[model samples]
Each structure stands twice: as structure tokens, then as C-alpha cells.
Target: MAAGAPRIFVSHLSGVAVFDPAGDQVGRVRDLVVMLRMGQRPPRLLGLVVELATRRRIFLPMTRVTAIQSGQVITTGVLNVRRFEQRPTERLVFGELLDRRVTLTETGEEVTVLDLSVHQLPARREWEIDRVFVRKGRKGSAFRRAKGEALTVEWTAVTGFSLEEQGQGAESLLATFEQLRPADLANVLHHLSPKRRAEVAAALDDDRLADVLEELPEDDQIEILGKLKQERAADVLEAMDPDDAADLLGELPTDEQERLLSLMQPGDAADMRRLMSYEDRTAGGLMTTEPIVLRPDATVADALARVRNPDLSPALAAQVYVCRPPDETPTGKYLGTVHFQRLLREPPPTLVSSIVDSDLQPLDPDADLPAIAGFFATYDMVAAPVVDEAGSLLGAVTVDDVLDHMLPEDWRETEFHLDEEEVATDGS
Candidate 1:
């Protein structure tokens, strides 16, 4: 590190607030932008990608950065209001560089890049890559000896691998995606080339791919799904929420849909078929068939265990349905629901049916969007059960699915702004 240089690990700078010279909060650092140069030269720092409160990403050039410490970034108050666009020659530290595997030039040993250290150049206002922190051995190997400390080597000492590498590089990138939230990973996937996106999707497990696909736009969802083998695509669909899986399958041709559906497990295929039977705007179409359903005789402890499942969404976990025999849909008979809140206040030994919300009427599968919306608004429930005419519990519609249907068709592509006018920078 340079003497007295304000060196910071790239990971540490993520989400740090950025402030203007007048001490006003501007935004938070989302990622660092760097320009790759020829040969072995360290990539030059280009700017900071800051995401404002409105979720608008703007660029703050290195010339505007004054200091880099105190858990926040200090800028000269000069910034371009235009959205940050990645140039062909530039790369993102967090999105592209971090968590990559590189070969040590000296020992030919491969290590995973954990973090990057950048420092301000002496006698210049520019920042450049200085060192990288790497962990020894490949990821998830039980036989590999633990390295007590991370090796910090100069950027020039390691051979940086390009993301275009179909083998190890792609694997390293996908491994890093595992650490991010599904929404965040979806955003990263959206920015990648179609080939790279397919590669990443192929590398992810069915559950993870399903979660990421759920967060993606419909077009992108179809594109990635098209790239997968029929069997693998069916597995991913099986892992997805029934409502979402049905929606995606609805976009395909009838023949294609049937082909994939036939490959899915019988139970999952049945749920998808049931969900697809209803109109897109109906309660049945928006509901998931996998809600926590228990017998009336079950204890509060049983309900709690089902709710505690990490795979269940918060809305689905918020309540449990009490039914007759056959806990699966179409459940034997619709009884009542036990809210998770009520379970917390009651003793574990207490019977769930004793505190069931009998007054809450289940929604009919044929109910329209407006009716479902009103039901949620009137009941103030996170989820409402959808029942058949024979009073069998079919599924539960979550509030999120309702809001998704209520939003504009292209709302996913729209960016909200805090104000119409751009603030003037003092250029201090």
C-alpha cells in the first residue's frame, strides 16, 4: 500500500453512503467502475456508481472524489445526473472482478479472489487497483487444508481470468451469485450477454434458478428457460412456486407446455395444471397450492414447525389452514385458518382448531382480480385461502401476487424518480 494512501477493500465500500462537499447525502456506493488497460497494467479506477434514494444510478467520476474514509465517500459535489452506462472497455469491481479465480504467476496455484484493495495514487487525484485478497484452494473442498489467513498479493502478481472463459471463470462467477439475493442476482443476470446468462443459469441449482427466474422479467424468464434442457427446465419449474410456474408455462405453445409438464413430478404437474385451469386474472391463477395445511386436530407446535420452513414465503408462513383428512389440495374439507400471530400467543399444546378464524370466508377460485383485491383490503390478511364450490381448500393467494397483477404491465421496466429537476452541484 502507498504511504498514507486511503486504501479500502472494495467489499467495504459497498453500500457506503456518498456525501457532497456541502455535507449533504447524495447516495450510496453500489459498485466501483474501472477501465481495463492493455497488458499487465492494473485497471484504472473510473468512478463510483451511486444509487440515489429514488433508485437511480448515477456516475461520480474519480475527479469528483475528494476522500475515501469514515464509512462514507466524499465527493467534490460535481456529478453527472445521467444514468451510469458501462462502456465496452470498463468493468465493475463487485459484479465482474470480485470472487473470481486467478492463477498465481509464481507457484501456478489457483486461488479465489475474495476482495480487492484500491489506493489513491501518490501526487495524483486518481485511484487504481493495488492488491487482491485471495483464499487458497477451490471452493467447498473438505480435503483441502484451511489457510489461516488470506494472501494479499499485488494485482500484477496474479493472472486475471476473463469472464468469457467457459470453464473455471464461469463457475467462479456463478458461485459468487449464490451469495446474492435472488432479486439482486436477477439484475446481474439481466445485464449479462445471453450466452453468459445461459451459462450462469445452467450452473445454478434448480431451487436457486427458480427463485432467480421468478424475479426476472417474463421475456428473460422464457429466454433462459429455453436454453435449459427439457428435463432440467422441468425440474426448475417443479421447484418454483406453483402460480409462477404456471404463469411461465402459460407463455409457451400448448405442445411445448405439455412436453415440459409431462417431465415434472406428478404432484407438481397436478398443481400446475390446476393453476392453469383458471383465467390469468382469477384467484386460482394467483394462488399457490403449496400453502401450509394441517388437520384441525393438529397442535400449535405442528403449525409452528410448518411455518418455520425457510423455503416458505413470509406471506404463506403467516397463516396455516386447518382441514379434514388429506392435507394436500383439494384438501378433504375446508375448515378454518390459524394466524401465526395467534399461534405465538397460545401454548404449544393448544389445539389449532380451537382458535381458528372461522368467520374468515375463503375466496372462490373463480373470483376476479378486483374481488380478490377487495377481499385482501377488507380482511387485511397477507394471504387468503381459495376454495372450490364444494368447500375444498384449493390454495392460498398471497398479497404480493395480487399487487403484481395490480401494477402496470411494464412496471418492471419503469424507474421512479424523487423529483423532476436535477440538483446543481457546487463544484467545491
Candidate 2:
């Protein structure tokens, strides 16, 4: 690293605010573009891919950059508003270089690259790769011993890496994604090429993949699902919320949907079938079949135990439904619900039925989106039980599902670009 040279890890530069010389906000750094060259030289920083307030991606050439600081980047006031399109020779540091595998020249050992450090070269206005941070040892293997702490090697000391190769880069990518929230992971997945996106999705566990799939746009969800094997796809669907699974299935061709559903477990398939039978905008379509349910005679302790499940969504865990025998949903008679707050206040031995909120009538499975929304708003509840005309507990509609239906059809495709101050203040 050069003395007095401002150095930043590639990961930190992502989402950093970009401003013009006048101190006016421009956009945020979405990615760093670089061009690979022959020989032992590190790739030179080409420019930046900036995402503006309009969600349009534009390029900022390195020549325009005046300063690179901790949370913000300064550029010459002049900027081309033209949307950025990748050229054949250009690659993204954040998108393509990070999380790749490279060989350490000293040890000839393969390590997954975690991040790259870049700095401006002396006597020149250009920035070049400075150091590479890499993690060694087999990924996801508990028995594998660490090869010591991550090594920060000079870029010149690494070799044998290329993003063009399939399966070589995914291990490191998924390792980093394991720490990201599903929404954030989905955003990164969305920006990747279809091939890379599928590769990353294939490496994720069923549960993690399900969560990311739910957060993605419908087209992306379908594309990833298509890439998965029928059996694996079924497993992923089974892991997702029944409502989300049904929605995704409904978007597929009827024959393809049937084929995938047939591969799912009978119980999960049945739940998906029931949810898929309703209109996309109806309560039944927006409900999850796995909400915590308890027998009328069950004690508060039992209800508390069920709500404590780590897999349960916060809204679903906020309350437990009290129902009559044949406890599996659809067959169970809807008695009432026990709010978690009530359970917390009551003695452990108290029967859940005794404290059930009978005044809060359950919504009919066929209830429209507006009606379902009103029910949640009126009761000030994050979730409400859905019942058939026979008063059988079918599922529970969560506020998130209801809101998804209420929002614009293309809401998932919408990009939310945080401003400079917001990114600086955000602790997460």
C-alpha cells in the first residue's frame, strides 16, 4: 500500500455515495469496472458503475473521480447520463472479481478470494488493485482445519483465476451470501448473469434458496426454479412458505406445476394445492398453512413451545390458533386464537382455550384482498386465521402476504436506492 494513498476494500466501496465537485449528490457506487490485461500486472480500475436516483445505471470513468473516501466518492461535476452497458473486455470488481478462487504463488495453494483492496498509484491518476484477501481450506467442512488466518497477499502473487470458468467461483460467493439477509442476497443475485445466478442458487441450501427465491422477482424465481432438478425444486418449494410456493407454482405452466408438485411430500403438496385453488388476490392465496396451531385442550406451555420455533415467521409466531381435533389444518375445527401476549401473562398450566380470543372471528378463505387487509387493520393483528365455511382451520394470512397482494404487481422489480446520508447512518 502506498503511503498517504486512500485505500478501500472493494466490499466497502459497494453502495458508497458518489458526489460531484460541487458537493451535489450524484449516485451510489454499484460496482467497480476493470479491464484485464496480459502478463503479471493486476487489472487496472476502468471506472465505476453508478446507480442514480432513477434506478438507472451509468458509468463514471476513472478520470472523473477526484477523491475516494470512506463513505463517499467525489467526481468531476460533468457526468454522462447515458445508461451503462458492459463492453467485451470490462468486468466488475464487486460483481465479478470478489468471491473468486485464485492460486497463491508462494504456496501454490488454492484459496477463495474474499475481497480486493485498491489504491491510486503514485505520479498517476489511475487506481490499481493493491492486495487480495483470501480464505483457505475446504468450505462448509467442520473437520477441515483452518490454514491460519486469511492471508492478505499482493495481487501480483496470485494467479490461475478466471470468472469464465463454471463452478469455480460459486463456493466463495455462497460463503459470503450465507451472511447476507435474504433480501440483500436476492438483490445481488438479481444483478448476476443468469448462468452465475443459477450457479449460486444451486450452491445454497434448500431453506436459504427458498427464502431468496421468495424475495426475487417472479421472472427470476421462475428462471432459478427451472434450472433446478425436479426433485430439488420440489424440496425447495416444500421449504418455502405455502403461499409463496403456490404463487410461484401458479406462474408455471400447468403441466410443469403438476410435475413439480407431484415430487413434493404429500403433506406439503396438499397444502400448496389448497392455496393454489384460490384467486391470486384472495385470502386463501395469501395464507400459509404452517402457522402454529394448538389443540383446544393444550396448555399455554405447548403454545409457547410452538411459537419458539426458529423457522416460524415473527408474524406467524405472534399468535397461536386454538382448534378442535384432527389437529392437521382443514380437518380441524376453528375454535379461536391465543395471542402470544396473553400466553406470556397467563400461568404456564392454563389452558389455551380458556384465553382464546373468540371475539376475533376468522376470515373466510375466499375473502378478497381488501377484506383481508381490513381484517388485519381492524383487529390490529399481524396475522389472522383463515377458515372454510364449515369453520375448519385452513391456514393463516400474514400481513406480509396481504401487503404483497396490495402492492403493485411489479413491486418486487422496483429498486430502492438509498441516499448517501442514509447509507452512512445505517448500522446494518
Top candidate on lDDT is 1
Tens-place lDDT digits, model 2, residues 1-428: 23367777888988999998888898999999875644456767878999999999988877678788758899977666657767545678878887677788988888888889888777555677878999886432457554645879888788964333233356546544445788878877777777778777876656678999998889999999999878778878977988999999999999999999888877788888988999878888888888887898899999998887556789999999988887888857888989999999999999998999998888988899889988888889999999999889998999988877778867755644223332211111
The TM-score that candidate 2 achieves is 0.60
Give, for candidate 1, the lowest lDDT window spanning 10 residues: 419-428
TM-score of 1: 0.60
TM-score of each: 0.60, 0.60
In model 1, the Cα lDDT at residue 254 comes to 98
Cα deviation in Å at residue 337, candidate 1?
0.8
